[model samples]
Target: MQIDPSATSHPALPFEYDVCVDRLPDIVTRETESAVRSGAIPTFVSTDGKTWVSYVDLFINMGQGRRLRDPASAFFVSPEAMRRISYSSDQIDAAGPDLSERNKVTLAGAKRIAATLAQLRKDLPPWPYDLRVPWSEDFDFPLAAFIKAGQLDAYPSGRCWWVRSVEATKLLPIGESFDDPASPWFVGPHGRADHAEVVRLSAAHRRHWPEIYGPALTPRVR
Candidate 1:
């Protein structure tokens, strides 16, 4: 994406960074713009359409373990998720990365993300933040498994939000199917109620599912 440095806003804190959308796919652009128009916060976009970033990326990055394999996945955070996380629209700021520097994915980016997590540890202190390694396991949700299942309905803002009925937690073997109601991983009636409660109560829970599961989750063909 062509980044226009002059039009960006820079926030003062560590998790803060600019969001430029000039390089995003057309679907992403449309989804993001619709979210903004429907009362969601308007994240900073470069006047030159070269840079863009969103609060969801920053929020996920704040956690202990996070990575972006598919940058397009950032859009999974819906407007409701943003409100649930208590992120303020006014908190967004735009800033420019060193444009002259040729952008290349390097170990340095990974290290920087790790370092940022380390600093967050010292600055925030980990009382409220509990760190645990995630596991890889598959789970099923027949109600919403079909690609078109939930796409027909619009969110409160008249935008369609992809619905996923079942998901695997961070702990389980990779590629394992848990769609059978009898699977231990299935969210059962007598399972640890607290765990299920946390999942239901938090948007971050869904956003970071892959991290919670070390491997990709596969849908069951029930």
Candidate 2:
């Protein structure tokens, strides 16, 4: 189904906040490594050669004060960990996989948004100075998933996938510190967020691409 443009002005209810984390255990890595040696992909690697395994734990505060323990809601594997299990091509291929028919539909909806963003970028200027670095790459799946689940909100426009308005009280604990190579939290400086800046830049994206964005706004989660 196509997204309606007029809905842009209609605001959804505020999102609730809670915390999230990465919960892969040591044993899982050992088992995974054994499998990798036996021909599986060894995506997990320690930054410092001495350490054989890498794991991460993050603190994510969903809008609500609660913290989650479920892997889906609280914990996420590091991209590096994921790489150990599969290749980038495979990961990209698995992006929108077979699932409940509803999920398939959701995936299609997301693809539409992705396409819109791709086109919008061609016409827009770089994100504002403060946001330029982090906004360089296209939005990632985790963030997109959060937006799809109504955990986050974005304003799209003819020019870009602008404005990312997250719940104020929420704090997402992205594991892997920038300083630690082995840590899953090591998203480069250009990968992190300056919340306020993202919001302001998103507004700019909206202003520029209003028309294309108009037909693309849909409920976060059907």
What does candidate 1's lDDT look like per residue over 26-113, in tens digits? 5555655565566453354434444344443343332212212234454333332222112222211113354232222212222344
What candidate 2 gets wrong by more than 4 Å, as runs, is 1-140, 157-187, 191-222
Give the top-scoring candidate (TM-score): 1
Cα RMSD (Å) between model 2 and the true structure? 20.1
Candidate 1 error regions (>4 Å): 1-17, 47-51, 55-68, 71-222
What TM-score, over all chains together, does every model reach?
A: 0.25, 0.19
Q: Give the per-residue lDDT of model 2 (tens digit) for 3-51.
A: 2223421111110101111224454434444544665321222233222
Pairing residues by index, what is the TM-score of model 1?
A: 0.25
